[model samples]
Target: MGKVVVVGDRYTVSLFKLIGTEGLVLDDPLNLETTLIKLKKREDIDLILVANDLYNPVKEKVESLVIEQKKPLVTVIPTPFSQGQPLDVKGLILRALGFG
Candidate 1:
């Protein structure tokens, strides 16, 4: 199976690394597009979980790229600051399935 990767801030990378997922520390929003493009080119990577902070700024670009391809699914994960609110699991699922 392919691997999962997390691209976010140091803390986000560290958190996922502990669970055996590979991660890259990306603290600059300006570099986010380039970073994601590089990751998408890797055959070994199957999914990318990006912290909400970093993902929010490039949401449109990221979504377009993901929807145009079949692999290396990119998803946004809530950061600590956004974790207090309840997640809309159903909406997420629907979107993931392209039913929303």
Candidate 2:
């Protein structure tokens, strides 16, 4: 089971690396498709960290996956974006699952 999974671009690498250094094993830093595919196969993942900028590029597709999979997804906005506040993507994921 994955303790935490972070999905984002190179810009968020440091932050996620810090997160990984703390003890979590993140998925490979590769194409989003591969990551999503792996995520789909893993039943142990409980949380997803999606960077704001990267999320925008794949928002529709990611949303579709989240809807189909119905898991807990968290959105992490970059410092320069979203006014530097962390919005709990869990809420969005919950809403998508009709549980919010």
Candidate 3:
């Protein structure tokens, strides 16, 4: 069994830490590559939750690691600021049907 990790910006990292999750807060984009490389090499980490905003920049590198190593599972998650509200499926259906 391996540990779960989260990597993202300061706000996302802080939010995960508040919930007692282990994570890395990337303050600079320049360090993104190095940080990801290190994480990929870590045998202890199984799942990696990356912020959607940050994932786009290093997506290729992350995908390569996933394909080659096949160790850590990387997933992109919406940032706190962007996760304002859940989608209203019922409202969307009604609007699509011209009944709302």
Candidate 1, residues 1-100: lDDT per residue as tens digits?
A: 6777888888868867776789898877667788888988999977777788887787776767656656778887776556567655446534654569
Better of 1 and 3 by TM-score: 1
**On residues 1-100, what C-alpha lDDT tens digit does candidate 3 reach at each position?**
5666778888878866765568898866556667767888888877677776776676776666545655676656677666556534335334433468
Ranking under lDDT, best-scoring first?
Answer: 1, 3, 2
lDDT of each: 0.75, 0.53, 0.67
Model 3 misplaced regions, further than 4 Å: 60-62, 66-69, 83-100
Clashing pairs in 3: none
Q: Which parts of model 1 have CA positions greater than 4 angstroms off?
A: 83-100
Candidate 3 matches the true fold with a TM-score of: 0.67
Clashes of each: 0, 0, 0
Clashing pairs in 1: none
